[model samples]
Target: MPPAKLKVGLVQQAVSDNDKATNWNKSAEQVAKLAAEGCECILLQELHSTLYFCQQEDTDAFDLAEPIPGPATEFFGELAEKHNIVLVTSLFEKRGSGLYHNTAVVFDRSREIAGKYRKMHIPDDPGFYEKFYFTPGDTGFTPIQTSIGKLGVLVCWDQWYPEAARLMAMAGADLLFYPTAIGWDVNDTDEERARQHGAWETIQRAHAVANSLPVIVANRTGFEPSPNPADPGIQFWGQSFITGAQGEILAKADADGETTLSVELDMSRTENVKRIWPYFRDRRIDAYDDLTKRWRD
Candidate 1:
């Protein structure tokens, strides 16, 4: 059985430059600090190695993609083994010529890859023009087995989908994690920003409530200017957080600060909550075939 109690850590930071070495070295310092504090598992923000470049699609941006087990995995893998902790990291993957993906790689106390998940939901909005870059994940919603527990790791856009979370939970994921890089459009009204932030936080909390599992979220902070001179760049809202099985906020970082947050989770609580909720037991699986359709109409 996985441990009844586990300690987890999240690293939330801002990216000012396109230097992978500088960004990763900063993240490494936090990982080392958290491991010394006795955290068993640590998650870094999505694409922590570079600035969010999807603000505008440029074919030249493809230069940023690298193969799996390349530099990122090798660097983070050493960190995980040195700290003897389960480390979760997100990267831009170059699968082959003209093939790329938003990928999350995992290392479990070793300088080797444990597992990886590609982002399934590709958002193609004004600022988040992801569909132009990532191919929808071929890796299904399978939880990666780690020493701490079964980690259902998903990228930023994937956090908004209930179907993704439910499938991971159904497949026996003990905890859900979102390595996120989302923020407000700087030109939006105050109210609009509030709504966007609220919706983002609420939906993930709902996933925890429905699935009876904890959720860990790490979002980047600071403003990354857009390549388009006329565009107001993304202000990556840092508020990285964790929630309990009952959807209670455990720990949360400030919205615009670089932070390393840690929290201890009780696995037994999820077991107890599921017993009373019993949502899965009563699910109408046989009658939900229509969910596969894009739209009921």
Candidate 2:
């Protein structure tokens, strides 16, 4: 059984353009600090090693991809062992010369890889051209087992899907972690920006309520200019947060700065919440065959 009470930390930091070495060093320092603060598990934002290169598809960006047990994993593994904290991190995975994936790696305090999850959803929006870089994950919706418990690890785009959360919950995940990179276009109006941020927060909280599990999101913050001067850059709204089983906000960070958020999760609350709101027991699985169909034509 997993521990009843667990303290988790999130590193919501800004990224620098084309500076992977500096980013790794800074993140390691943050991890060390969180470990000192008694955080049992630490989560870093998606693509934390460098800028969000998916803003525009460039052929050279493929150079950023590295093997699973490559340098990046080794660096984080040493940190986990040194601090004796479970660490969750996201990376651009290089499967081979022509294949790649958006993957999350979980490390136990023993300095060994616990498990990994390949992001299932791939978004291809204007400033988030991910489909061009990542191949859709074939790893399915399996949760990663760690010392903390089963972790439903998903990427930015996967957080928006209810099916993903439900599958992870059914598979016995104690908490869901989204290592995300999302933001607004500089051209968007102030009102539109607020609406976007509100919607983002609401959707993830709803996932927590539906799954009867805590939801933790770690997102990058600050402004990253577009490579092409003609296009508006992205202002990554930080607001990293942790929510309870009932969708109550446990802790939230600011919108524009780098910070580490630590929160305690009561693992036993899921049972109490689910007993009163038993959505899982009444699921109409037999009547949802059309969910798998492309269209009902």
Candidate 3:
């Protein structure tokens, strides 16, 4: 028999500068709300402890990075156990002095550290200076195994990479989750802002259709100032959502609101879709060596 359906929860919230306590409390409240609504799994936005602080290369931001099993994990572990739900969290991981990574840590239903995936792609765009703070991830493409099924998780920038999604599907992931932090530069016109957000959501939906796995993305919302005086600040667009195996939007939150959304995910649909589409059966792996290179040369 196939695994039973699981109700997934996503939290979309705003953040303030360097306020871990506030963020934790807010997140805890959302967790409880979602659990009350029957969410079996919960996901939060990227670097959720602080406002998307990477907008500048401030030395002070390093203080936000913590060890994997450190304070936040311990707290979240307890919450997971209390709710009896799987928890997916994004954090700033302090690997060593001057070394850190953007990571996703999963707490299983039993409230144990089930698995983790370090973000492989670090974007260095304007108003988003992530490369300045995060050391590129060493963890390769892999999924976190839970009582429900394997979870294919990647960070914000990693969401744009189809190869990453494919590897997770090839590795037998039952679902895909992208804990994200992305938004519009306040300087952009309204039209540009709309287009950017649309593109971001559209691409992830494509991944769901191609890989035949449910996709969950939780994003932070609200305006965070640029740590650098020279750069314009960013308005983090929320719109956190969950998509089914067919890439259909299951639930989507407001672009600027604090919301807890839960959607029922049919675990069996993965195999059902794959059998009908057969994308995996026709492997072009033998002819895909160019994908490994920096570029076609």
Candidate 4:
């Protein structure tokens, strides 16, 4: 059985250019601190080892991809064992010679590899050309079982889709964790930027209420200039946060700074919330076949 309460930690940090060692060391220190603070599970932001290389479609960026159990896994695995805490991290996965994926790996406290979730949704917007790098995940909406509980791990793009969260909830996920890398275009108006950020957070919070599961999001911070001089680069708006099953904000980080957020999640709250607002019980599964279609037409 899962514990009644789980203390989770989020590492919201900035990334510099090509400084993998520094990034890893800094995040490791943060993880150690969170562990000392009694965090049972620690989640790092997306692509924590390096900068968000997907800002442009440069073919050379493929060099950033590495194997799943490669250097990163070994590094974080040792930390998990040393700190005795479940660790969640996102990685640029090199599946094979010409295949890659945006992947999330979960490590049990014993330092063993528990499971992984390849990011299902791959966004290809301007200043965010992920489809050029990652192949859509073959791994379905299966929650990873851990000592703390079953974790519904998703990537940045997947967080926007209600279907992803619903599938995980139906599969018995105890909580939803999104290791994310999203931000502003640097050229957008202040009002547009606020709207984008608000939508990003509001949608995730709605997922928590809809699934009756606590939601945890860890996002990168700071400005990473574009490799191409003509481009305006991305200004990553941090604001990493944790929300309760009732869609209430539990903890939140600053928008432009690096910080660690730790919050105690009451696992039993899911049961109580579901009982009062039983959306699952009222789901019209039989009448939802049209959902699979591209459009009503």
Candidate 5:
């Protein structure tokens, strides 16, 4: 039997400063538009309801985080049901008092959250101080079952880890979706910026090739100022994109613009490409004991 095909929409847009209501409304408009255009699934950028505010460690930002079935998920649930489409969204989840996580929720067409994946690799790099805010995800590498198909959902930092990708693929994910909020550090040299962006894109593309599964990456755009006046804020290079099983770029956006990229995937291509490449079949799983260690040394 031929593999099923589905139309997926990726919303690549810039977010405002700490304006949750506006951001949610903007995302809803885009979702509605995509549904009208006949898309079966829609993916939004990471932390779509707020700016990439992790640049500074402020106690106030924690207030932005809400419960899973709280206001944001409820809003998305209604939208999913009204549009009759599966929705993928990333949010700051308030698991409990003083405990929060960067989570991606998958809503089936029935408007209910089927499953969610909390980001595992929380980066504490200079401008991206996520560790101070997000508690590392405890939800293991598992695919979220949806009306469209199984969704291998991961957050921004997790995208760089091969183990994360491999585990999801091994768990029978039909496609991988990455909701990202990455940006360029303005203080870096031009060459440094180019190298950083290139590495980021290359790593994720390689994941698609290795897994022989389509990958969708939705990123935010525009320049957001650092809440702290001392440091320069990051300039987000949108360039959201989608890649096929062979790591071919199907669609892409520009550096600073709002774009909704819709692409159709031949879900069957995964099996065909995997058969020819056989990366999984030739894996040295038995010899990979060191992968569980924090470091080889």
Candidate 6:
């Protein structure tokens, strides 16, 4: 069994451009900082390699994609092996010609890819046109086994769904990780922005509570101007956080700040909490057959 206690860290930052090297270096600096601080596992925000190009649908954005064993996996993999830490990273993956995915790659204390989880949910809202760029992940909700524990890595939009979290928990994930890039429309009122951010944090915390697992999330910060001149750009809210099995906030970075969150999580708590809560033990698996349908109507 993995150790009962493990130190975890997260990096939140602003992506100013699509220059992959600069962004990776920026993330690398933070990873080194966290590792020096004794973090055994670290997470980087979603698509930290480039600007959130999903803001618009353009053929040119496809140029941003790269293959799995390509540049990104190698760079971050080295850091993982050097620091002797399990690193979870997100990137835009080019699987083949005209085929791409918003994917999360995990490296477990080695300069080799441990596992990968593709973003299963593709959101298609204004200023967040993801469906145009990504193919829905065929990799089911699976945990990436590592030196520390089992990490259930999910991407940005997948955070909104309870089903995704539950599936990962059922698959024996010890920690749930969200390498996210969610933010508010800057034009929305302060109240609206507050509500959106609140909902975002609340849902993830609830997942931790329901599943008796720790939750770690990393989100980008700062405002990125819209590619189209007429639009008000998105404010990538940077409130990355780590929460315990009971939904207690352990460490969190404030909104609009470029920071790292680090804390030691007690893996044993999952066993104790689940023994008391026993949500899985009491579930009625036969009654929810309609969950796969588009809607009950």
Over 4 Å off in model 2, which ranges? none
lDDT of each: 0.94, 0.91, 0.88, 0.93, 0.90, 0.93
- Report the lDDT tens digits of candidate 4 across residue range 1-297: 469988999999998867777899999999999999999999999989888888788888889889978988998888999999999988899999999999999999866789999999999988899999999999999999998989999999999999999999999999999999999988999999999999999999999999999999999999999887888999999999999998899999989999999998899999999999999999999999999898996
Write model 5 residue lDDT over 3-104, tens digit each, in one string. Answer: 388888999989866788888888999899989988889999999998888999999989889998899999898988899988999899999999999999
- Provide the clashing-pair count of each candidate structure: 0, 0, 0, 0, 0, 0
Please tell me which model should have the higher TM-score, number 3 or number 6: 6
Please provide, for model 3 over 1-297, each residue's C-alpha lDDT reduced to its tens digit, 9 standing for 90 to 100. Answer: 226788899899888757788889899999999999998889988888887878877898888899978988888888899999889998899988889999889998665899999999999988788999998888888878888788898999999999999999898888899998888888899999888999999999999999998999998888888877887788888999999988999999998878888988788887889899888888788999998899996
Locate the minimum summed-lDDT window of 10 residues in model 3.
Answer: 1-10
Better of 1 and 2 by TM-score: 1
What are the per-residue Cα lDDT tens digits for candidate 6 across 1-297? 558888999999999999999999999999999999999999999999999998888999999999998899999999999999999999899999989999999999998999999999999998999999999999999998887778899998999999999999999899999999988887899999889999999999999999999999999999998898787889999999999999999998988878998998888999999999999999999999999999998
lDDT of 2: 0.91
Off by over 4 Å in 3: none
lDDT of 2 at 216: 92
What is candidate 1's lDDT per residue for 83-146, written digit by digit as tens? 9999999999999999999999999999989899999999999989999999999999999998
Report the alpha-carbon TM-score of model 6 versus the true structure: 0.99
In the predicted model 4, the residue pairs found to clash are none
Can you tell me which runs of candidate 6 are displaced by over 4 Å?
none
